[model samples]
Every structure is written in C-alpha cells, then in structure tokens.
Target: MSHFGFENDIHSVLKLDMPITNAPMARWQRKASTSTSAHTGALSPSKSANRSLSLSKTPSKTPGKNGKTQSTPSNAGGDRFIPVRNAKQMDVASFLLSKENEPAEESTSAQANQQANQKAWSVTLNGYDLEEAKILHLGGKPLNAPEGYQNNLKVLYSQVPTPVSMKKSRYISSAPERILDAPELRNDFYLNLMDWGRQNLLAVALSEQVYLWDAAQGDITLLKKMEEENSYICSVSWSKDGNFLAIGTSTCKVELWDVQYQKRLRCMDSHTTRVSCLSWNDHVLSSGARSGLIHQHDVRVAEHHTCTLRGHTQEVCGLAWSPDGRYLASGGNDNTVNVWSGAQQTGVHCFTEHEGAVKALAWCPWQSSILATGGGTSDRHIRLWNVNSGSCITAWDTQSQVSSLVFAPNYKELVSGHGFAHDQVSIWKYPSLAKVTDLQGHEGRVLNLSLSPDGSTVASLSADETLRLWKCFEKDPSKKAKPAGASSSIIQQHIR
Candidate 1:
C-alpha cells in the first residue's frame, strides 16, 4: 500500500468513538500525516517549492563518533517545537494519577551479605587489644628507653582535668528605679546635700529645707526647715547608728538632730566659714568648712569641740571617715587630699596629685587602707590610694567633673556622680576600675551620690533639681538582710 494510504488506515483504526476538538491532540500525530491541509487541497507550487528547499537544507541525521549517524528530532529547530519524551523523563499526567505502593519486607541476600561483611570487619578489629600508650616527645634529643619496651601501638585513657569555674557577671539596670522632684535643690558644686542613712532613710537638703524620705514606709517627713533668709543647708550626713543626722548650714553652723524625736540635739558653731561637708565617726562628728579647717566635735559632751585639723589651704569640700575610724580623709578645693591619723591633729599624708578641686571621696568598705578620690572639671580624674603607704594605687580619667563618690557596702564596686559634660552616674569595678554601666537621665550636672544601707540602690541628685534612684548593685541572696538600727540602742544609751 502507499505511505499516505497506510497512515490513513492506522488513524482510522486508532480514532476514538467520540469526536475530539483539541488542537494539541490533532498535532500529536506524525509530521508526515499532518503535512496536508484539512481541506485536502494540494499546496500551491511556490509553497511546495519553499517546503522542499527547507527540507533539503535541514539534515535529518547528524554524524557522531565512530562513524555513527544519530537521529535528531524533526521538531527541535521548528517554530512550533514539541519536545520528544524519553523513557527516563517524567510523565506529569501519569505521576499525578499514580498511587503509592504498599510497604513490603525486602528479602534480598545483598543486605545479609553486607551485615556479614561488617561483622567480619568488627571481629578483625576486636582481635587486637591496646592496653597501654607510649608517647614519643619529638623535637628534643633522643633518650634511652627502658628495657623490655615493646614497639607496638597501644592506647591509654587518662583522667580529664576539671574545668575552672568562671566568675559570675554583674548586671546593673540602666533605667532609674525611682524619680523624685527635688525643687529648689542647690546647684552649688561645693555643697554635699544628699545622704542615705543606715535607717533606710534618705536625707536630702533642698535649699533652705531638709527632708527625710523613709524608704520602708514610702513617706516624706520634714526633718527641718530654715526660716531665716540667706540661711540655707549646705550639707547633710547621717550618723553611723542612723539615730542622728548632721546638718551643715551656709551660715557657718553645724547642727545635730535626733530623728526619732524630730528635735535638735545640739549645734556646733566651731566652723568660722560655711560648713560644706560632714562625716560621722562614732560619737565624734567631723565637719569640713570653707576656711579649709576640719573640726572634730564630741556630741556627747557640753564642749563639743575636740581637735582641729589644719591641712587644706582652700575650702574642704569632702570628708570621709575610714571604716575602722582610724583615719580621716579630707578633700579640699586646693586640689589636695589629706589623710589624718585619728590621734593626730595634722594630716599624715597630704596628696597633691589632683589638679582641680577634690570634693568626691570614699573609703573602701572591704579594705580600710584604700581610699578613692575624684577631682573637679580641671582634673577630671579618679584616683585610688593606699592610705597606709601614702601612694596612689591607680587613677582613671573620667572626662567629667566628679561630684560625688560612694563605695557599695556589700560589693567591691564604686559608684561615681559626674557633672560638666555628662550629667550621669557610673558604676566601676573595684581594683580593676573598669566601668560596668552608665545610668543617665539628669539634664544638669550630677551633684551628689548616696548608697542605700542595703547597697542595692543608689540615689543621685543633680543640679536640675531632680533626684533619681538606680538599682545599680544587687544584694547577696545567700545572706539575710541585717535589721536597721540594730546598733542604735547602744548609741542612744550614750546620748541619753
């Protein structure tokens, strides 16, 4: 039969019962069968000539390796190209209609052979036992080996050394825990107007008045208010027992008051100039004045004046008694730090290291011989000194005026209040002097810093008339908090 007649017979045999209208289904037939038009009319001569020329130009087979002729798909380079599918290629319709196979146990001897090979390898390894290890230390001269040393591979297990425990890191909250409006607070850098007492009370002197904030009760009490004009409070300090508070005035007077009765116990007028700083050492209260004189007053007797210390040439703005009460540290506007022995009337060591006014001073609670002092804007340095040796241990440039310094009672850390450029509070690691965190919120220079009795909170006062409290130090959870004013009874007996 003719080729066209054979293709027509095959199409008639494979045709479905229903008529299909899809173009793709129609075009899926062999190219030779689809070469004629649906109207069955013969092509024009020009079109037939062009088709014969295109067919002659396209080579059906390409010459491949070893004189082999490979058949190339006829539709590969055509305009309406359809890819020829191979057995390895996926059938999307078939895959979409296919169902998952049932799970069955594979019974192939290849897996058993693999297991047998692994068992043989493991048994071969177990035949040799390594009971000892000998290490050859290379790079050095050869040493004679002991007799009967075997030259064989051996393994030895050594006990691992325990790792050293790392020190716990400290975290300080950057945000202020509490904020209070301190209206009319003095802006003078020479004044020390804020102090946290051992009774858990915060004493803040605002211009002409002094107030006591009870941390336990969350109440404010008017400790004392100066009614006279031009007579304002310059400094405030709490006694060691927290039963009394010392008030320094701009009028060159120092007044002692009993907080329990809210009455004045006695007033010391030994200072010729304004008293700028006050520190209590047991029954004796030391006051630093603008005259550069430090007066020791015995509050128990009618004659309160004891010994007068004359070392500073300018106003003495900072004073701190050592934890053991064996030494007294005084910082003055003369840029000098004077350390006085308890029994001597003159300073034992007068450190002239600071270039600016030294008003910030703190004694290490853990080390009685170490003292920390900070300088004003001209100096901007924090110096740690060993009072026993009269030598500076270390010093750091704070870059800002140091206004106040307070050592954390329970921690080996120090908190400093700064002014001038940055009105912020800084917490420093002791000995290392590395800064842990900077707590900032004040709009003006920080003028004062005080630590709570528990040493967990720090109270900062700034020239902007705002008082901020930060939870800078954390309390030791292993130890219980001591009762406030436990030693007050003993102190009260002496006062009574």
Candidate 2:
C-alpha cells in the first residue's frame, strides 16, 4: 500500500538541497586553461605568444610617471631566446606568462592590476620547489563528474529487526479462562442482571433469586429469592463500599442487602415499574425503572428517594454514575441517553444517537465526562459522548447488537458483549478503536459483563445460561494489582 506523503526517508522530508557554488569553480577553470595551453602548445593565445618571442630577451629601461626610471620589457628581440637559469629571468618569464592569457579588449579593471598580479604570481610559483610545482598542476583529471551519471537507487531493506514481544498487551486476554454456569440466567434485554463487587463477590440475579457468589472462595450463597408471587430479581448492583449489594426486583422495590451480615438492611419502594438498572454513588443508590423514572435513593436515610429524574420514555436499562459521583448517565429502550448532573431531577442533556434501545452505559474511569453507550440490534454503534457539550466525540460499529460495554479498570481498552452475527465478547484497544480480540465460547447472546477489581478478569453472563470468567484481562504480577489467582478459588465450585 502507498502511504501517500508519509512514506519518505529523512533526506526527502527535510529536503537538504545545498546550493553548489560556481565562484570557486570559475577561478579554477580559468587557471587550468591558461596552464594547459602553455604545456600543450595549443592554438590558444598563450601558445601563440610563446611561439613568437613577444616577451623581451632582456629587460630594458622605461620612463616612469615619477621620472624615476623603472626597468620594463622594451620589445620582442627575436623569434626565440635561449632559456636562462637566472631567478630574475624566471621572474620576468612568469610575469609575461601571467599576462599572456588576457584579451586585448578585456576590462580596464583587470588591466590596472595586471602588473601587480603578474609580480605576485611570478614570486609565488618560483618559491615552490620544482617537484612541488609539478604536482600542483594536475591538469589530467576532470574536476567534476562526467555528464549523465545518475545515482543508482539501492532498494533499502530494513535490518533484521529485534523480535518484538507479541505478548505485550495493554488490555486483558480476549479469551475467557474458565466458564461457570449461571443456570436460569434471565434472557431479558433491558435488565442489568449482574455486577462484580470490589470485595471480590459477584452478585447475579438468576430468575427469581439474587445470588451472591463469593468470587474469592469457590462458594455460592443464595442472598435473596423472590417469594412474592410474580416478582423476580431484575437487576443487581454492588455499592462503592462493596459491603452492600443492591438488588432490584420486578415489583419496583430495590433491596439493599448487607453482604457481611447476609440480611436486607433497607428496601426502597418508589418506582411504579420493574427496576431494570441500578447504580451507586457514595451512599446514594440510583434506580431506573421500566416506567422511565430515575429515583435517587440515599440508603442511609429513611426518606431514601431524594430526587426523581424524568426523561426517558421506555424502560431504563443501562445506568452508571461517574467515579467522582458528580454526574449520572442513563440509557433507555427509547434509544436515548440522558446525562443528569448534580442533584437535578431533570436530565441536563439528552442524546438520541442510537436507533435501537440504548442499554449499555459506561462512564470512563479515566475521563470524568466521557460516557460510552451501546445500542441494540437496530443500532449497533458504540458511541463515546462528551456529556458537557452534548456532542458525540467518537463512535465504533460493533457490527452486532452491543449488549453491554465496560471499560477495563486498569487499561483504557473496552470490553463489549455482542449479539447477532457475533455472539461473543470483543475487547477493543481504547481510543484507537481497534479490536484486540474476541472471546467466542458463548453459543448465544452475551447479556451482561462485569470486571473484577484486579482489572484483568471479566465475568460474562450470556443468554445461553452460562457465566464465563475470563482472565482475558489478566495483568502481569509485577503490575500494581491483587496477587495473581488471589481469588482463583472462586472457580473451585464446579458447575456442570
């Protein structure tokens, strides 16, 4: 593939075109021609002057401007004179030789300095030894390269590169390490049926029961089972403290259970429809219902329902609170995402970019305002939005229904549970939006996905009624994290 303008070497990029100077070359050329004509006795002016004895045989006196007579050449005495060894004769001959190349019609500026230039040349040439003088006039070599010598292009092959470690991964594994069965796991599209707690306990709502499975110990404890006729656990969320688990039921009441004591501490009963999504911000447990009402419950107080956000039309299936507890993002089956800032009951901004139900809502752990939401089958786009500006910053086509989106706690990569043509979990390399890999063991839709505090392990609950634990995001032991397999016992309970 052609890289357009980018595939060039450093030389082409900088364009180092140094100007070749001609001033020095002109001076050297003139000197060479003059020297060559005298040696070869060519038809040039210097050769003609030498053949006829235009230079004087002896120095004669000429009247000077100062009336102090100066010695000068009188006239040509003969066709040739016997060569003399005297230094004065050689000096005169050198002076005459220097002037032999000048044209009669040359500039007067050159003629004015003729005598002085000749005297300098005469003195300089005689000072050099005969051996050194012979070496000085190397007239045989061509000064520059002969005409059409183009530089041959040597195709550059890069050096044998040091093998780069292919194992260096910024995100967790794309493949799941183990699969656990969450039998009777609901196949609903609008319910957030599972969550991983910071305390290593995974809370999953399987049909009518909300089970708290000890992720650190290979044991499962039935936390709560709906006995109230038609009511079933629809959603599950873990509080920031990890000691508490919030279970939302079809009856529209949210039960705050104390994980340590194994008892219901509080029940928030304000919603009219089934509570589909639950998110926690400090002491506040915000629950969204099928009625599209968002009730904020401060669990520590009796008047738990402090403020109610009214915006979504359909069932609110996806919910997330920012890490700092400043903003709340919620996605609904109405195909809209709402950003609720502060304690306001009304959504500050509403986004309707998805054509299908917007059920996957994730707040970036690294960025406070960036919210990532995924659409259903009709809209298979995962868009990153800036809540403050109400603008969609970037989007990616999952090419399948995006059931869930969760960013890795340690790396920027995002894990998306998909349905349709690709009923698998795909991990993407963050902002680059490149698919790192896909975990593909589930036979059906991946309904929900949760990440461990270690950042590497991800638990996927699929519609196939199987819960998979992927060390897909397992990190290096040297990295700042809980020791590897510190909670490996969580997989000890064999679920056939």
Candidate 3:
C-alpha cells in the first residue's frame, strides 16, 4: 500500500527551481540609481570617500566630525546600504555568485536528509529479509546516527526479529490424533461435525444427512438422513448428553433427531425465515433466524415451539446458550445483542454498541453471565458484556472481521475466526484478552468453530470444504496459561 507520498520502496523526487541571486549587479544598480542624489548631498567627493573609509573601519561606532557625533540621515528608500570599502580585497562579485548557488546545494542536502529520515523510519514485518528491507524505530537518536553507526547496530532489532521460513518448519504427516471423517456417508463435502455422547464418538452433519463414526472401531455408519419438506439444512447441534440432535434449515424449520433410535422425534415450523444459527441446552433448542427472531423449541414437546424471543430489528446471525441454561444471547445485522430468558418477549438486556453487523456470539462456559460478541466490520473487535447490567465490560481488537467465536470449554481462552484475513483462527485469553496463538491451515472463510469437551482440541469448519482439528497447547498447566510470545503455525500435511 502507498503511504506518505511513497510508492512501494521508491519516492518520486520533487524538483524546485529558484532564481539565482545577482547581489553584485544589484549593488551596482543601486549605486547608479542613487548616484545623482549622492552627488547633490552635503558631503563632497573627498568627504564622501573619507566618510566611506571611516564607516568601513568603525562599522559599530558612528563617525564623528570635530570630536562631535553626527547622526547619519536615512536614504529616501528608508534603508541604509553599507558600501564595500575594498571591493578588490574580497571578491565581492564572486562572493555574491557563491551565495546565489548555496541554496541549491542546501536544498540537495535537505533532500538527502529527508531520504535518510524515511529510510530510518521505514517499517518491515521481518517475515522475509529482502535486500532493500529497512527496520523501523519508534523514537531515538540512534536512528539518526551517522551512517557508520547505523550499519553496525540495528535499532529496535528485537522488535523486528527475523521469521523462520516455511521450508524450515518440518511438515510431518501422520494420522490425526482425532479424526471426524467417516466412511459410510457419501462425504461429498463436510459441513459441520461434533463429538457428543458419553463415548464422544464423532457425529457429523452434512448437507442432507448426519453420520456417526466410531473412532475406536474405525467404523462409519449413517446416523440419520433428515427428511424435511423443501428444507436444506444449514446448521446442527447435539444435546449435552448427545442423546438428541437439533437440526436447522433454510426453510426456518428445526427438527429434533433421536440419535439412539435413528429417527425424527419432532419437527418445528416457528421461524419465518432461514435459520442462521442453532444451539441446544438440554431439552431447550434455540434457533435464530434471518427474520431476527429467536425461537426456543421444547424437545420434550413434539408438536410446536415453546416460545419466541424478539428484540433485534434485523436478521439474526448468531446465537449462544449460557452454560447454566438461564439466558440465551443472540446477535444480528442490527448490530444489537439481545439476551433472552424464559418465555419473555422483551429481552432482559440489549447491547448495541457495535458499528456493523454482529456475526457471532459466545457465552463463556466458566463464567455463566459473561457473553462475548464479534461483529462483521473492518474494526474487527470482540466485545464482552455483563449480561445483568447490559454494559460492555471490555473489547479486544483483531486484524480481521470475526465470523465465528467459541470459548474454551475451560473458559480460560476465547477463539475467533475471520473470513477476510485468511482462514486463520486466533485464540485469546479471557478478561485480559491477550492473544495466545493463531492457527493457520484453512484457505477459506471459517464459518463455524467449537471447542472439544475436554478443552484439549478445537474444530473449525471452513468454506474450503474441509474440517480442521487443532490441538491446544497450554504451556502452563496450573493457570491454563500460554507462552509469552508463542504463535501457531499451519500443519500443511493433512492427517491420514
């Protein structure tokens, strides 16, 4: 990107042309212009010559006649021009010519100084040490030091340390410590998958089907194929016990699937628009729709939805259920976050500080009342809110707009995924919001993310049509702490 009149590494030179001075000619011209007046003045030729001699000799002290000081009258131009006593002693003409040329040299020097300053201040990411790369300094005399010192010592050296090249980080190929891939289903494209049930077997939700994989036995089988009229499934979730699965679709209908029996238990037609997000808290399944309405379906009941919560004035894009099951949080295009409880039509609290559409929301599992919401805007900030007071507690800025968010099962960490800035997933610490690490691998927008039950792994679904599992590396076990300056790298080789 171009900045501060600089294009890439080159700056266009600006040429300024200034007229050279003619000081000697000016003096001669002035003498000629005032010759008639000087001749008509009181002093005679010899007196004027003596006056000039005295004036040159005693430049500071005024000349006096007969030991009495005489004031020098101002010229008609209201300014006194001192004449050169010996024009031959000093090359007056040459001196004036040199003075005229000095500005050009000074201007060239100034340009060189400016170029030096820019080179000293130019910033480099250190990802690659290119030939013309320059290091940046915050503020110090070291950057402005002479060329000899600058060449030997790099200012702010630590700030721009060299990055290890990709070729050096050995990419190892091995079976994933955990794999969600199943063999039974068609497996055209992986949509969303989860591990639920006491056994924690892999259960994947696809375009129109759900599959179950037994990793211990290496067996894959179809759990259920959703058969809803005119509906294309968009999202799915399993109950905390994994006994039931909640499926949401384009028709805005939600269906409860009995995984054990492999049959549909109930179907709900509550939302008027397509469902964008789905969350389940035991028997209560909450579905957020494009119409900005949140419908809670009671899986215990077969025929209808239990209640509808409304507050958002635009399409609802994200939803989360507080671990305690007391509150449900929803965010939408209206840039408002609404917290719902019970069958109440009025939201308990409304958070509306985001400048753009809110895309994802997550409730901290450990802190039942703390809710985090990320918006789809260039600002790329995630805001944490105190549900009770409806006030923002803190906000953390990211490099790209967040499309999905999930708190670590242990609640010590928060993860967010951006669509525009690569498919990199960033993990941050709670409260302090310090960046822990960034996982890179997916080449498309990460639309869904979830932390495993043990908080040891994370699963991210991307538009690249692949599912990635990341193993969380907590350097300090006692405090669930991360390394001070640790960062994550992509595992290029896919798990077998």
Clash count, one per candidate: 0, 5, 0
lDDT of 1 by residue, 1-496 (tens): 6999999988876789746565454332433344444336688878865655554445668788989999987657544556778765667646544522322333245467777777677667865322112354333443332222233233122233322210232445556767888888889999999999999999999889999988777788898989789899999999998989999998899999999999998878888899999999999899999999999999889989988889989999999999999999999999999999886656689899899999999999989999999999999999999988899999999999999998986566789999999999988878778776789889999999999898888989999878888875666533433334333121000000
Q: Using lDDT as the measure, which candidate wins? A: 1
The superposed Cα distance between candidate 3 and the true structure at residue 392, in angstroms, equals 1.1
* Model 2 spans > 4 angstroms off: 1-175, 477-496
- TM-score of each candidate? 0.63, 0.63, 0.57
TM-score of 3: 0.57
Candidate number that wins on lDDT, 2 or 3: 2
| Stronger candidate by lDDT (1 vs 2) | 1
* 163: Cα error in model 3, Å: 29
Order of candidate numbers by lDDT, starting with the best: 1, 2, 3
lDDT of each: 0.81, 0.77, 0.65
Identify the superior model by lDDT, candidate 1 or candidate 3: 1
Q: Point out where model 1 deviates above 4 Å.
A: 1-169, 476-496
Give the worst 10-residue stretch by lDDT in candidate 3: 165-174
Model 1 error, position 104 (Å): 63
Tens digits of per-residue lDDT, candidate 3, 110-161, equal 7899877665555334432332434643343232322113133333343333
